[model samples]
Target: MSNLSGKTAIAGIGATEFSKDSGRSELQLAAESILAALTDAGLTPADVDGLVTYTMEKNPEVEVARALGMGDIKYFGRVNFGGGAPGAVVLQAAMAVATGVADVVVCYRAFNERSGRRFGAGVQDRGTEPSAENAGYAWYTPHGLVTPAQWAAMAGRRYMHDSGATTEALGAVAVAARRHAATNPKAWFYERPITLEDHAESRWIAEPLRLLDCCQESDGAQALVIVSAERARDLPQKPAIIKAAAQGISGSTAMMTAYYGDDIGHLTEMTLVADQLWADAQLTPADIPTAIIYDHFTPYVLMQLESFGFCGRGEAKDFVRDGNVELGGRLPINTHGGQLGEAYIHGMNGVAEGVRQIRGTAVNQVADVQNTVVTGGAGVPTSGLILGADR
Candidate 1:
């Protein structure tokens, strides 16, 4: 456990409308989301003295600040590992606020990921200039492992082998997410729930992963405003206290080709995140009544449940076997839909959902919710949050 835990809170969250195409520049979207977050916190851009964002996002922090006409930024940072970086953005902001490096920090990610560059479409061409980073991806890229589905299929197939989970189990995850999404107007799949059969029939992106198994390529941005827990109480909204914020990278971690580990089906990075979160927050899986696990891929959702000790290893298939993840189930997930149903903003939307859940303002609010979990991208160097309602 660390002193940083429970010291700060996410005071507000804001986002641009999710869509297939924003028809706007990424920078403009970044500015819009920041302004929205500031307003949501009942503050102006001048109140933000720190900024954190994804390294992969095209928008730069200084540029975004200038666009928003912000005050002098005392702290600025960029986190890596694609979607895995979202939680880290909040972690950075929380750390800054806790240490007084900055009084207020806004963490954001914005992009035209769908219309501009679809990550689902896979690697087209990496420029000649490369480094140690590309070497890991290079090992499998030449062997038909260029796409995320392809990489996930290798991992999912191994999971089924070790856990006896069938492709149908993966479909069940997609079904639960879509069912939640059906009622969420912000979800891309809102009012369009599917069945196990629909998942079976959907075209395959990879052998083990169907089109429904993968998440949507969305265009949008999400931002969160963070301040000291003391400061949050005086703000205009209820505070979602940051019980814990942690990031991890297992020894066996790779970009997406994390195939060197003893168990290919497991998300060890998430496990690492879980250990720190639970200890730092002084809580357990049983304490969390709601969750917003990343659903970029359905199988990873199952692995996350296991990694977080919600279920034993190789038991997630059974854990999610029924309608356990749907509304009114033991663990209702992605109430705003998910990356699969909601427009994917690289997991930032998931964190915002966590804030909403703690604030009791979620569109699909869970009953008597107290503690909530928000996980980042599962396969890469990841992060997570344990958010609780202020006592």
Candidate 2:
């Protein structure tokens, strides 16, 4: 629906190995991934004129440019909302390229989340800083709503209550992701596939969320090179055209603890993203052969399916239970293993997998993936993308 559609494409993708410890700085990881992407695109550092990353990323754009000896950057930007930012970075880069603001833009994210700082540790000791985001934490922190799992558990419980989904439904998502991951040599959980019984036996991180339900805390970086569709056609790799990109924030809510909303079980922000993606791309759920649904938590995966209209509201449990989300299924999702089975690079890895699917080079490659829908984290301000084969 906008001029940006089909104007730019992700020409190449690259990433550092997913691990719990990188034994390197986040800046090194960023630089390595960017260089790898440039090489994959048959380009060089001097070709880069724009950079985009998450606001939470410690590596600054200037530092990364310096590390790679890149040219003078004409455009540089940062996106917010933690896990919600993976797609937003690409959106910024695509806009910059489509508008003639930059010729080649690289979007990247790198962190030492597992070894350096674990987000699962929750709020430890905070400085006496006052901000709007911190202010929201005050309301729930006193009530022991600290970690991500705790917040997700509340929503998972409500979803099960309203939809009649048992804990087994959540386990199904984990099981499917692990099955995909078991074969993906790049996945952290490769050869570690789990079953429904394994999920049931895993220790509970929260009431409804088990250890398997949570995504791994990984340390790595992923980068994608974006350029005008015309330029991308000349590149070495098949370009994953950006058919649509959108970000959304619906109800007044905090990061993951938006229990004050009318319904804690639904993700309205993701619904808004879905509506925009379908409308902007002039496509429907049936048009997408596969998807890389963000799996920060298992329940949110189900919520995303319903929000994206892949299934009716509260029908995701039955849909996933019926084996609709596995390889060779009706709508196989997260063929790269997902955050649950693959290492969680904060959903950036999922986007790369979408590109791989479009290129028909994925490990668990689907049959006819003309288009792949990739979504960011739910339960927060989120984003989504529709990547299609160049027609």
Candidate 3:
């Protein structure tokens, strides 16, 4: 096992309410969530010596620290990519604490995605640039593959075509997430459950990807407190020990539009991440009874299951159909509703749910959840985490 495994733990998790309009600035959301997390950890701003967030976050570490009245900070870092950053931010914090670079580090992501900057609305013309990030999009953006759903549709369609899977397979993911959300009072879709027929009738944003197949573009913030395992054991809340943390990039990695890779039907990046997570944690799919699978798009959820070795390639459709991914099943995924039924805080909320399951305090708590898998966004240079109960 890696030296980082079991060395750091998530002492607390917090989030702002999920909604279409937060009616607040991203900075305020970040500050609120951070304070809430510190309080949950039975800590104070004075105890924090580090901060981590996504590179896309507008609030700088020093600025947020200033807002929170936090004292001297020894370490601060940022991870790139959109939804793929959730686990990565925690990874950064865990590394900092494990390596003695910081004592207590908080990972946060706050955004006004729905009201301020909707990601599903597709990309805008910022003119041309000589940058590599822009160049990667040039190959497909002009072809009208701008929105995340559209980019993901290309892969989803291919997976269906190759695996003989129908749109019903995708709807299965949506239905399960909503079912879990129906009972989760904190979820936006609370008491709002849908059937496979409802998913089938939903308007198609992109072919093979119905509106329900897409995750919500929500306005919210989520945060987590990371500290040494020994320190966390002394805290009031049950610590979600960091069993493993990993990030990976595959051939010609390019956000969601990695169609040029060896196989457009597979999430190779996530496969790489999954391989490392199990190895680093010295665990396997059998050990994890539940997971917080990234559901930015439903099709990717199926792909992630296969990539993580939960099932054979092209067999995820069958696996999900067998009632294995829902409550009382073999692997209850996204028990807190996921990005589809819950709020989309760039997968940070999903990570929080994993911690809750470890603490046995989740609204849709799974039985015997010794460990839970938390994955970042797929179809990109993604990240994943394995959170287990304190040993």
- The predictions' CA RMSDs to the true structure, in order, are 0.9, 0.9, 1.0
TM-score of every candidate: 0.98, 0.98, 0.98
Clashes of 3: 0
Over 4 Å off, model 3: none
Against the unseen true structure, what C-alpha lDDT does each candidate score?
0.89, 0.91, 0.91
Q: Put down candidate 3 lDDT per residue, 1-391, tens digits, no spaces.
A: 4678999999988889999999999999999999999999999988999999998898899889999999989999999988898889899999999999999999999999999989998885745788988887788778888899999999899988888778888988999999999999989999999999999999989998999999999998999999999999999999999999999898866688878877787888898889989998999999999999999999899999999999999998898885678898878899999999998999999999999999999999998789989999998788999999988
Model 1 TM-score on a 0 to 1 scale: 0.98
- Per candidate, the number of residue pairs that clash is 0, 0, 0
lDDT of 1 by residue, 1-391 (tens): 6788889999989999999999999999999998999999999999999999888988888799889999899999889999898778889999999999999999999999998898987874754457776665677777878888788788888888899988888988899889988998988888999999999999988988899999999999999999999999999999999999999998798777789898888888989999999999999989988799898888899899999998899898888878888888888888889899988999999999999988888889998778999999988899999999998
Cα deviation at 6, candidate 3, in Å, is: 0.5
Candidate 2 lDDT over residue span 1-391, tens digit each? 5667899999989999999999999999999999999999999999999999988899998899999999889999999988998888889999999999999999999999999889898874544479877777887777888898998898889988998888788988999899999999999999988889999999989988889999999999999999999999999999999999999899855589878888888898999889989998899999988899999999999899999999999999998986679998888999989999988898999999999999999999998789999999999888989999999
The residue ranges of model 1 lying beyond 4 angstroms of the native Cα positions read none
